[model samples]
Target chain A: MNVVVLNEVRKGFYLDSVALMRLSREVAGSPGVIEAALMMGTPSNAAIMRNAGLLEEGTAVKGNDLVIAVKAESESAAREALDNAIKSLDKPKTQGEAQAAWRPHSIAAAVTARPEINLALISVPGEFAAAEARKALNRGLHVLMFSDNVSLEDELSLKQQARAAGLLMMGPDCGTAVIGGAPLAFANKLTRGRIGIIGASGTGTQEISCLISEAGAGISHAIGVGGRDLKKDIGGITTLMAIDAFDADPETDHVVLISKPPHPDVAKSVLERIGRSRKSYTVCFIGASEVQLPANARFSPTLKGAAELALGHKQIGADFDANAVASRLPRSGRGGIEGLFAGGTLCAEAQVILAAAGRKVASNAAIPGVPKLGVEPSAGRDRLIDLGDDEYTRGRPHPMIDPSVRDDALRAALKNRDLSVILLDLVLGYGAHADPAEHLAKIAADRGQDAPVLVASVVGTEQDPQGRSAQIRKLEQAGFIVAPSNAQACELAVAIVQNAGR
Target chain B: MTDQDRPQYQQLLARKVEVVNVGLEGFVKDLRDCDIGVVHVDWKPSAGGDPQMAALLAKLGV
Candidate 1:
């Protein structure tokens, strides 16, 4: 085999994981290419490139360097394949977008051109967000921060400064929000109405808003304060602000506060603030057990219940039949679940619920009982790993937007001899992968039906771009016991565990 | 926020929400595509996000 190693092919800039994977597929399928791989010069990536014979002696590259290694039938063919990989990586996301020269030079410059800009949507890398947010706040603008990887110190300082400056700093990692009926990053398109929501979890906010919109109640606004806002340090700064905004808005007749279980002090602070609310509000602290809320605020333990309580309506819950799931428990092999989830908050909720039910759970998340998968990768009787966590997606897109990493995780978990049930969450929406369940079907197809029962849920409505029914159908076809919600999916998994052939 | 900033609390709630997306210019495109007013911040992390914060985080053992 003839190998042509493009040493330090592209440097200074990084290709996103999606683009990297797409480039590899494109190059591998090109003519005369026996094998091809394109990756950054990370240690793991360098090892793969070297082992695959895609590297040459004295090839020194940094993590930022792009390495394209190709092997072909001949030297000329290898060079040609390498050339194709470069072209694919350099290709434009959209032909028209690349051709269009309407790109602005900077934020201050863009604001100068159009002074109507009241809000600045900040999605820069985590470290730079504080500086950029400072610039926006100085300009008397509100910020919707969508970047993560920011330090807790910077986050606290930024939020404090925003509050002092009289501007809203939505997130260092906030993913979804709707302001004045204008949907922001990773938000669903919904009609304007009276129900307003503030959540610390992006997907949790989405799940509730989508549920409300589907039940014939439109959303007035939804603000995401990020996952860590309710922690002790940040102390629910944005959450309190959002609640007051919803309280003051005449358009928002009722409101809801959704989140993963918050820090005790933060929760009490928020609860005391809610005690003073004049308008009706519901609190769905996702995985919290029963809590006595103030007279004005009702505690909802589930996302669906929060939506239902906010609208003063009821719908039949999709009860996961424990008997039905138990009937099909794996007769042999491991009997515990190893849930591989794509949504962090959903994974946290599952851990919280299972822990409350007295189930042994361990994970890569920060839940109390669930130890970090890094420190204890194999501690839990049931291992639940949130593939969307930063550890898993360091150089890749989120699992929701890119399922390759999640698929890889699932395949790894399936190899475990003690795995009797596999739990997953298929969160579908506009910005999510176009057809995840279609992809899930392909991933789980190799697993024999009797190997382990698959339990899952699709956190989307029928109106999503990826049709809910179609995705559910694909999952069902893959032998997944599709539950109605994340909580139900956990219940189904627990039941499967309880009845697994001992 | 500190106690003195209670008055500024009304500032964010009083105004209409406008977004300035810093990195990932695609987010600006997405908001604009949805007909929501948005602006790109053309961000490169004043100190490049990586070296400065990473060095600090490493030293602080965060």
Candidate 2:
């Protein structure tokens, strides 16, 4: 392959991470281009390119410099792709760009320019998220923090100040929120009905909303409280506030709260608030079972169950006949399952299911009774891994939107001859990978039938931008068995393992 | 909520939601395409995309 690496091209143009990510994709899609990455020359970025064998001798790059790298079928193709890469850097503007109002260089300038503006949506690097979020909260603007990797201490302080100011601080890692029917950050294009969702998990919210829509109901709003809101430290501040908002809004009829298993005290406080709401609501805390529900609160252990309960129907979890998969197993030590998931909640759900089936399943993050996967154990284990966790996405886009890293990791994991099942979750919605199923399906097609049975769930509605049935059909064509929901998919995988032992 | 203890954000729910997009212009475009009017908050940190940029934005806010 012909490789082209350009150092220090754009001096101070200041392209944010999203712009850089799109630029990389555009260049990679160009004719004859095998691979390309256009980004600021940070150490992590440099390390990424170096791993791909792009960095060269005497190539001195710094964070402020624009580093362009490309590999192509020929030197000429590399040159042409490099030209397109540089052109992408000078991104053009639309006709109305000149007529647009000036951007205020500071939050004060912004608030002064538009007094009606009440929310500041911050998407910067993880380390910088707190400072920007704090500024917005201090200025009386509710903050929607899209950046992750923020310290929990900063989150607590920010939420504390926001509470003091009577403002909402949505997340340091919030995924989806639709306030007044405005979808933001990885949310589905949902309808404006009377049901509002307060969720900590991104895909969990999408699954619930999509199901609600399918059941002939719509959504009023879906507020993301960030993943850690129900933890003991943050104390479910956003969860209670969102419940209060839904409780007060006359437009809202029913409410659904979606989250992973939370700390007991935090869950109790949140439950008490929900118990007090005049209107009844549904709580779907995945992996958090054996909880007593209040008279006004409905409890669901799965996302699909929550949606079904919210619609006044009981959709029971069905049993899957994965015995055929078990019979094909090699009956050797390599018969473990490797679940590489993009959604942490989905990963946690699978981990819980596998553990309940009397198996050891490790994870990179804390998974209730499951032990934390040590540095090396996390590499290869009978584990359900969250590839979108901070460990895998420090300087990269989330695996939900960018499948490059996850694709590579999964391909490598599939090489394990002992792996009996390769489990995955394909989430289709706004800001998610346009066609996530296509990549994994290709990988599944490459692996032999005896290698690993690829089982997956498509977390979306038929109305999703990426057609849900169409995406599932692609996976099915590529020799994959697709399930209706993530929870069901986990059950199928567990049965595959148990049947193998039989 | 009690008038004395009602949250400050409580009033915002009743009003029309207007957004100020910071750092990423594409989001502003996305919102506008959705027919949701958005205002531009021109914020460029001193170090652009680095950790130090956060402190710079805060200083600018003050």
Candidate 3:
């Protein structure tokens, strides 16, 4: 086979990262194609292409150019893939074509066309997100930024501007939020209730909100304060604003705050602000050590616990029979547990639960007490890996958006005879993959009974586009012990490992 | 906090949610399916992704 490389530059063309990634995936899967990438010609993206050997040495391109690079078995294949990519790019989007004639090209034009536009959902590249968000704030709009890789300094300045203007800047990397009853990017369609949530972690918020909704409780509004807002430099500016907003809204009777352990000073100030609220608050700083709580606030260590508290109910998993679930598993060997998760917060929650059970679980996104996974294998140590970490997703799409990204790692874990149980999460919602469980189920089916006991959970509601019950049925039919929630999945995995004499 | 002391964003809760979606057109379907009013902005990197030129355009209010 004669290997050939080819490139095409669409001058001043632009596409969002997600679209580019999806298109790249299609091109790479074409006949005889080894690799393909569709990226903006930004400096970082150029470096990525260079490192992937898709770009020739000394190839110069402007940041606004769309770079289509492909490597294939033959020149014809490479040329075919390049042509396919361009055709896909030029194809008209069918979703909003009816309104295409009236569609605005800029924030200013959008506001001019619809002057009542109150929110801006910004998902541009990180280098440009701050500018777009700034433009939105200047127009008196609340911003929910779904973009990541933004500089901390840019985040600080943007948040400060939003705060000064009495507006909200939800994220530089904010993923999930529901305002009034409208579910924003990567959010769930939750029932309307009096419980308001402010979350720094996207998946953490989703887990808690879904749990609350599943428990027959609903949400008034779920505000996302981007992951870094509670750090020292940003100082929880959006968090404080969210608290004040919830306190003032008569519709919101209770508030839930979810995040990983925040900066100590930031946490202290947030707690103090929560103390002043008339409404009760449930704060779940996942994996954070105990801190003093105000009279109106209760502290929870897990997302499930926060949801249970907000709902005034006993543990949502109180009826979960871990032993019964474990007993049904076809355990073969005495081995450590392997957790491969797409949700970062779900992965951290599992690490916390495992660590609390006197187990040392190594993870890529480790909590306070747990240690990071080392390059060398450690004997008898359980491993929980967050596949969405930058280490695994620098050039690839997030596992949640493209579940195939976790296929190789999942397949490896399935074949590992030393693993007692392979734990996983299938997150479903608007922005996630269409049918993540079906994808995983196919992989597990390929390995047959030779694989370890597969324990999993679906983090979504029945109302989600990918029905929760259907996803669970797929996993269970594929021989997976499907837990109701992520926390319970961890518990079930632990029980299986312990039953196997770990 | 009293009703008057509420942060400016509290008022947003009572108003209808009309969104200006920047960047991805893929998100438009989700919003439309939810029956929320949305307008998509065909966004691209400004000034051909040249930071100096983009900054100058911003200053000029273009």
The DockQ of each candidate is 0.27, 0.50, 0.65
Score every model by TM-score: 0.82, 0.84, 0.96
After superposition, the stretches of candidate 3 with alpha carbons farther than 4 Å from their true spots are A92-101, A375-379, B1-7, B51-62
**What part of the reference interface contacts, as a 0 to 1 fraction, does candidate 1 reproduce?**
0.37
TM-score of 2: 0.84
How well is each residue in A163-259 modelled by candidate 1, as lDDT tens digits?
8876677888888888776777777777678888888888888877876776678888888898889999999998888877776667888888988
Better of 1 and 3 by DockQ: 3
Quote the RMSD, in angstroms, for model 2: 4.3
What ranges in model 1 sit over 4 Å off?
A: A1-6, A9-21, A24-82, A89-95, A99-101, A289-292, A311-322, A325-333, A374-380, A415-417, B1-18, B25-29, B39-62
Flag the better candidate by DockQ, 1 or 2: 2
At residue B31, what lDDT does model 1 achieve? 67
Candidate 3 residue B2 Cα shift, in angstroms, is 8.4
TM-score of chain A of each: 0.84, 0.83, 0.96
**Backbone clashes in model 1, listed as residue pairs:** A119-B18, A119-B19, A120-B18, A120-B19, A120-B20, A121-B19, A121-B20, A121-B21, A124-B23, A334-A418
Clashing pairs counted in every model: 10, 4, 0
